[model samples]
Target: METVTIETSDGMPVAGLRYTPQGRARAVVVLAAAMGVRQDFYAAFAAFLAEQGIAVLSFDYRGVGRSVPVAFRRSLRGFQADLFDWAERDYNAALLAAKAWQPDVPLLIVGHSLGGQLPGLLPDNHLVDGILTIATGSGYWRENAPQLKRFVWFMWYFAVPVYTRLFGYFPGKKVRKVGDLPKGVIYQWSRWCRNPHYVSDARGRPIRAGFEKIRVPFLSISFTDDEMMSRTNIDRLHDCYRNARMERRYIRPSDVQAARIGHFGFFRPQFRESLWRDALTWIEQRTADRNQAQSAA
Candidate 1:
């Protein structure tokens, strides 16, 4: 893997890592990370896909990992980053970089959690060939698992607001939450999670309309043991992409022969043989199908 810098349309430079295949490449895969998760978290998965002949790009969204600006490193004082900036500036920059890197090859996204939802919001999303979503669901407290619902409510209504206000930013890392999150991101995320429909509710009709523009094939994987996302929650989130060809699959711990497969467990190195291999197969078949269609035309 090699480190590269990607410049967003707005002129901000973000850090990225590229994994190139040994020989000919089948496709270009973008590893879109979950909120507050660093790009390094996806490094192993990206390397695995690269070995399977796919060129992969794993990047940190602005305000996280190596992508954090020098100015914000000291403190988030006066920093005004938000979720919209994540979708518009960070993810867009990464996707644009990936697409430009291998213009002729198929461009695909392997999105985790919040990463899954933002793809539809990309204005140039038509350039993407397909998307695979993992453990992504509505962040609404009401849609969380029954056991976690109350805790989620407390986190949203009390913890997030109070903590963010007290610290100027969410001290997620210190609290052992997602990661240390920017104040703007945590505040906007809190607003969405508090709403019954999550992002759809907060942004309303215009955002829903943006989702309708997604026409690519989508494969969404949900874990039954994920305390954060119930099946209903996953469906509620994916439903925003009304025009997409979507397939939702639920995986249980028993199916994977594991004691537990929670929201974040899917990307663990241990699952590389079982779950990761299947993802490669999906990419291969999808690429073949697209090629055949193009040839037939």
Candidate 2:
């Protein structure tokens, strides 16, 4: 595993992990994990891809994991307060950096959860050969969002407005080190529930249109019981991609025979092999078409 610190087009520093196979590569995958995820969570996937002759560039987002930026004061309002632009540009820069570092390699984007929605948002800009969105979604995207976030936002819409007026900004519930999330991310996310295309900047471009422009072949893979993304998000993604070919599977945790393939299980210690088997198999079947085309050409 090789490590490097690279800057995004927006200049936010991102830490990248490159796992190269022993021999020459089959392809390169630019991986994006769920929001708040670190690169280590994707170690198993990277290692598995590398073992299979595929190289990976898995990196930390702008403010997640090892790529913590010098956060500005939280008082900035509206667009200035949103980190979505920073995060999106960081993803693009990671892909470009991967190709720049390995010019001859074929590039495939593999995004999980929020990362899943990214390639569709950016579409087939020449930097990519294809895209794979795993357990990704459009907006209000808490897979558990309906029961969890709808309630929280109902509470926050009332509770937070008062608190923000008092505290200058509402201090969000902290899970891990993402302390005091700014209201802007939440506010924008709320708007996304109605309009996923609500982007304040070009870097934070909307995917609904780009989703239609995805000319590169795409593979949208998901588990039925993903904790953060519902099956509907998967359908929405597939429907929007004009030239996409999708393979959908549900991993049942209940059946003794069914793998314990929940959203988190895909990264957990116990279910690693099962998760990789599903993912690698999907990649193999889809990319084989491209491989054959290249060979024949």
Candidate 3:
């Protein structure tokens, strides 16, 4: 894995890591991370994919992890970034970088949670060949998993507002919620979660139009044991991609011979032999199918 810097269209230098296979790559994947989750969290998974002959690029959005500006390093107070920037700029940059890295190979995205939802926001999403979303869903609190509904309500109704106002940002690390986030991000995310339409309801954005524009192969993987994303939430988000050839799969722990595979457990190394192999097969199959279609055409 090589540490790299990706410059967003606005000239912000976001930090990232690129994992290249020793052999020629069959595909290049941009591993978009979940909300408030650092790119490093996917390091092990990315490396595993790399070892399987897939080139992977993982990056941090501007306000999180290595991309955090110097001024906001100590505190996110006055940091200026929202979910839109993360998608339009940071994620877009990663996609472009992956394409440039292996222009001849298939380009794919493996998005986790928020990472999965933002692909629609990219202006150049037409360049993508496929997307695989894990533990991704609409953030509407009302549609969340039963166990997390009330807690999500508390966080949205009370904690987010009070904490963001008091600290000039959502001190999630201190509060032990999502993780530290910029003021704009928490505020915008909270508003979306409060609304049933989620990002589509965001003030002036053409989010739904972007989703409709995506025509690539798309797949969503959700776990029965995921404590955060319910089947409804997952379906609601993917429903936005009306034009995509989309498929949804739900897995039970017993299917994978595991005790529990929650929202975050899919990427854990323990399930590597079982869960990871399945993901790799899907990616390879998608790439092969696309290649076959193109060759015939």
Candidate 4:
């Protein structure tokens, strides 16, 4: 594992970690993180993939994690970051970095939550061979878990706006929601969660092109007990990628013999034996299939 810096198009430095296998790697996998989550959160998982002979690149979006500039970290209230910047700038930079690091390898993505959605927004998304999304779903309140509907509503209508205004940002750490988020990030996310189409309307107009260009093979995995993302939500989000050759998997805790494998539990070390190994196998098989197809052609 090596810490690396990727420079965004907008002249910001994004922090990342690159995991390399001992010998020749089968393919390269980029691990994009969830909203308000740091890059390091995916470290162990990246290491595991490296052990499986796949090179992995895990990065933090600008203004978060090790990428946060020292000046901004001292006074986070002054930071200006949003979901649009994450999609256009941060993910773009990470993709460029990955290409530069492994010029000859096929690129795949393992996106969690918001990370999954951002790739569709990038113009060069077709450069990727495949995408696997875990616990990724539309944040539309109507599609959220029924029991958490009221709480989700409150978060959008009350907590987000009020907290962002008072603190010059959303102090998510205080509420144990999603750590501290930039004002723009939380506000934009709240707006999207409230809408049915979810970011389909950008700057008051419909974005007609980006997502449709993502024709890569895709896989989505959703847990039965994930508190934030219901099956409806997962389907809604996956539908956004209109051109993907996609497959969806719904895994129950009992399937893995666990009492509960919630939204975040899949990355825990305990799951290394089951879900992690299975995921590696799936990635390998997909890569092999793609190689065979290309050779035959």
Candidate 5:
């Protein structure tokens, strides 16, 4: 594993880690993290993929983890980032960096939660051959898991607006919600969560057009017990990719012999034997398919 710096188009430095296999890699995966989740949270999974002959690049978006600038490390009150910046700038830069790093292999994205939702905003998403989304869904509050609906409603209607106004950012760490986030990000996300159309409803944004342009192979995995995303949420989000060749898998905990694999359990090291292996199989198969198609062409 090697530490890398990816400079966004706007000149912000994003911190990332590259995990390379000892032998030639069959494919390269850009491991995009969920909202407010650090890139390190996916380190073990990235390393595991490397051991299986797949190279992986994982990074933190601006205002999160290592990418947080020193001026805003103490507080994000003055930070000027929103979800759009994370998708259009940070994630796009990482994808470009991964392509430059491993030009010959198929490039895929392994997006978790919010990570999966933003690819549609990327102008260069066509550079990716495939996408594997884990625990991703539309953040429409009404479509969230039944158990979290009430709390989500409160967060969207009250807490987000009140807190963002008070602190000029969302103090998510104090509230134990997602995590500390810039005011723009939290406010924009709250708006989307309240809307059935999610990001596509963002005023003046051509978000849906971007999704419609995606024609790559897309695989989405969601757990039956995901506490934040319901079946409708998952379906609604993937439905945006109307032009993509999409495959959806909903895993029951019993199928994997686990008590419960909630919104975040899929990335736990405990799933390495079963769920992880399944993911590896899908990635490898996609890589092989892409290679065969390219050769025939």
Candidate 6:
């Protein structure tokens, strides 16, 4: 594992780690984790991907993680809401960086939750072979409210915005209570919560056009009982990707007992091998088909 930095088109540096195999690889897989987790959070996943002889690039999005250039500007009363577009630029830069580093290999993207929605915004080709997203969603926010409410996490969207306006950016140190975030982070996030376009289906909908343009083969996987929202977004994706070979898997919690997993527990010490086994199985199978085609061509 080597530390790396990918500078996006807008000049923001995305901090990440890249893992390489002993020799050349046929393809590259770029992974995005839930929320805005740093590359280190995905260390196990990257290691396994390297073992499969596939290069992996996992980075922290700007304004979060180890990425530089923090957005300190808050709206005084709130944030301007436009800086959200910068997130897209970071995604583009990450993709460009992957291609730049290994110009000859095909690329596949694997995103979790919000990370899953990003690849849809990029141009597709032989350079990008396929996409796999786990616990991902479409633009529907309404479906997630039930769980968000049950967990008292709803305060994040409903109350945190108001708090940030008065306190500037709240520090993580003072967050003795839940639902508190940095002033800029909460403000920008609240804007995203309202925009569903960045996170949901966009098939000719008045909302977002980016999703309508995602035509690559996609695999959306869901646990039978995810601690978060149900697979509404995944279901919506299955419906919208009419032209792509889209598949969904709903693995039960008992399947979890057999799998011995919890939400976000896949890479923990107890479950690491099980996760590696299952994940590599999927990557190997899907990636094998892709490799054969490139070889035939």
What TM-score should be assigned to candidate 2?
0.78
lDDT of each: 0.85, 0.63, 0.92, 0.85, 0.93, 0.60
In candidate 2, what are the lDDT values of residues 1-297, reduced to their tens digit?
989887766665678899888887767888887755677888987888889988889997654566654553333232233445535577778878788766766778888766776665452245677777767665443434354445545533565466545554444432222234345554455455444443324445554665555667676666666655567655665666666545555455653245556555666545555656666766666567667877899
State TM-scores per candidate: 0.95, 0.78, 0.97, 0.96, 0.98, 0.79
lDDT of 4 by residue, 115-197 (tens): 88788787567778889999999888988977778588889988998888998988888888887888888888888888887
Pairs of colliding residues, candidate 3: none
Q: Give a tens-digit lDDT track for model 6, residues 260-295.
A: 343465556554566556766666676678668878
**Compared with the true structure, what per-residue lDDT tens digits does model 3 show for residues 161-212?**
9999999999999989989999999999988888888885457343698889
In candidate 3, how many Å is residue 257 off? Answer: 0.7
- For model 1, state the Cα shift of residue 193 in Å: 0.5
Identify the runs in model 1 with alpha carbons over 4 angstroms from their true place.
201-206
Which runs in model 5 stand beyond 4 Å of their true positions? 201-206
> Candidates ranked by lDDT, best first?
5, 3, 4, 1, 2, 6
Steric clash pairs (candidate 5): none
Better of 1 and 5 by TM-score: 5
lDDT for model 1 comes to 0.85
**Global lDDT for candidate 3?**
0.92
